[model samples]
Target: MGWLRAAVLGANDGIVSTASLVLGVAAAHGSAQSVLIAGIAGLVAGSMSMAAGEYVSVHSQADSERAELERERHELQTDVEAEHKELAAIYASRGLDPVLARQVADQLMAHDALDAHARDELGITEAFRARPLQAAAASALSFAVGSALPLLMVALTPASMLLPLVFATSLVFLAVLGALAAWAGGAPMGVGTLRITFWGALAMAITAGVGMLFGVSG
Candidate 1:
């Protein structure tokens, strides 16, 4: 579930971007070969970009967490008493009585001091730890899958009807993807579908307009 949000975002971007590219090319009266080429190139580039971006972002998070843990480790070694008191104070602030807080802190430290402090004080839990590789893989795979839908439409549709067909199909695909994503996350499906469809339509429209203007001028 941790990767779900990132995967959804990656997929949505892939669909919008590749579809928009295809529609834009088609709008400019480009040949089917040209449209297919553009779509394929966009899909490959987008997937790689998503993978790299997710890896860098998640790796940064992991680095920060490691740095914080190192700092905590140094503090624990240099001033054990201060670290104990600090943990006790944290628990006390959360609602425990002062005496009970201290007792609980002592027990936690005796069991696994760093783990307890990382979880309670630093808010870095195992469940939420960043995994760069996992994030990168999820992002790339989802993007590729989403990008494929529009490219597949291009391959199947006639060149004369390419623009409208891709636009219609892409919107439907985006809506369904958004609804499924929202439903999986326990959100309102209708809202998600509408939101995605609106944005996707806007992207394609803007791109198509630009391509037409440029194509005519060029």
Candidate 2:
């Protein structure tokens, strides 16, 4: 679920940002080759930036989790009896009777003290820990895939129709990407899809308008 969010966001940003950049440059009377170059550059830079950012952020979270787990392990090692009692108390607070809680805690501790405390007591586990490299790779790959669509359109479309073609095609892609993201995150597909397409349209429209105005002034 966590990874899903990161991947979707990376792809969405890649698509929208690159598409918007190409449209803006094209509106400013740039040639197809120039627009394609700008789009490609934006795609590469954005993907690398997203990956590095995700890596650093996830690594920080992982480090914090490790520190917390280490602290818990040390506490368990230094004061075994106290840690056992603390675990029992946690169970008791969660509605178990004192005697039953003690028995359950003792049984769990006997099997794996650190695991027991980390899971039941502190709500920490290896499963939920962040993976920095995995997040980085996902971001990079998703961004690259998303960015390629707009670049392809710019590369193949006739110059006379480049702007309109890019706008229409990019909107379609944005809506699809949004729906996919929503589905992956267990969200309402319609709202997510519409929301993304609306923002993307607005961004391109505004940028195109500004570009045209500047071109006219010049």
Candidate 3:
């Protein structure tokens, strides 16, 4: 279900971005060749941007987590008793009685003090740890897949109907993606569909307006 939601979001970005690019160009009276080229450029640029951005962002997160863990390890090593009291306090605050919390904390520290502190005190679980390379690759792949749709439409549709078809088909694609996302998340599919389509339409309209305003002025 989570994967479905993620997949929907990734494809939505690709479709909306590429479709908006081509539509803006077409609306501005660009030639078919020009529009096609713009869409392809956008897909490539956007994919690389997503990849780089995700890598930097996730790498920073990983670094922060590592730094925190090192600090926690130092604290644990220097003052085991203090660390035990801190863990007990955390448990007590979470509804355990003071005596019980102390006992539990003692047992946990005896078993795996670092793991307990990392999970409870720092909120850094092994399952949720950041992987920069994996994140970057996934982001780039998703963006590329989504962006390819509008480019495919450009190849198949006549130039005369390019703008309308891109606009219309992009909306349809968004609707489908939204519905899938909603279903995966266990929300109302219609609401999700409307929400995504509305935003997608707004984005395309704004970009088209920008292109037209400048196209005429240029």
Candidate 4:
């Protein structure tokens, strides 16, 4: 679900940005070829950008986790008793009685000290650990897939029909994306749909206005 959520967000960005760029170009009375080319370029650039951004962001988190774990491992080596008490304090803070917490911490540390401390003290677990490559791939793939939808509209619709068709269909795409994301995350589908659609609409409107201004000026 975490990866799914990231993919969904990346897709949403791809759809909204490509759609808005194409619509803006069309509004400016750009030729069909011009808008089509613009959409393609946007797809390529947007996917790459998403990939790079996700990689950098997630890599930073992974770095922090590594540094913290390294420090914890050193502490465990130098001050075994202190680390045990620290782990017990954590368990106590979570509502366990001090004696029980100490006993549990002792057993856990004896079994696997680093793993226990990593999970309990630092809140770093395998399931939740950041994987930069996975995030980059998911973001890039999802963005390209989402951008393809709007590009298809550009290909099929004639110049005269491009603006309305693109806008209408992109809104539908966003509504579906939002609803699916909401369902996956156990959120309100209607609220997600409304929120995503509203932002998409606003972006398109702003882009169209800018294009009109430029078109009129030039």
Q: Pick the candidate with the highest TM-score.
A: 4
Q: Is candidate 1 or candidate 2 better by TM-score?
A: 1
Worst 10 residues of 4 by lDDT: 1-10
Ten contiguous residues minimizing lDDT sum, candidate 1: 1-10
- Per-residue lDDT tens digits for candidate 2, residues 1-218, read 44766788888888888888998888889888888999999999999999999999999988887888899999988999999999999999999999999999999999999899889877776777688998898988888888999899998899999889999999999999989878877889999999999998999899888878777777
Instruction: Provide the clashing-pair count of each candidate structure.
Output: 0, 0, 2, 0
Question: Per-residue lDDT for 1-218 in model 3, tens only?
Answer: 22233346567888888898988898888999999999999999988887787779889989999999999999999999999999999999999999999999999999999999999999999778877877777777888888988899998999989878888988988898888778877899999999999999999999888888878987
Residue 128 miss distance in model 4 (angstroms): 1.1
Which of 1 and 4 is ahead in TM-score?
4
Candidate 4 lDDT over residue span 1-218, tens digit each:
34675699799999999999999998898999999999999999999999999989989999999999999999999999999999999999999999999999999999999999999989899988988988889999999999999999999998888888999999999999999999988999999999999999999889988988888888
Model 4 clash pairs are none
Instruction: Sort every candidate by lDDT, greatest first.
Output: 4, 1, 2, 3
Task: State the displacement of the C-alpha of residue 146, model 4, in Å, after optimal TM-score superposition.
Answer: 1.0
Deviation of model 3 at 199, angstroms: 1.9
- Pairs in steric clash, model 2: none
Worst 10 residues of 2 by lDDT: 1-10
Off by over 4 Å in 4: none
lDDT of each: 0.92, 0.89, 0.87, 0.93
**Candidate 4, overall lDDT?**
0.93
Count backbone overlaps in model 3. Answer: 2
Instruction: Itemize residue pairs with steric clashes in candidate 1.
Output: none
Candidate numbers, best TM-score first, in rank order: 4, 1, 2, 3
TM-scores for the candidates: 0.93, 0.90, 0.88, 0.96
lDDT of 1 by residue, 33-74 (tens): 999999999999999999999999999999999999999999
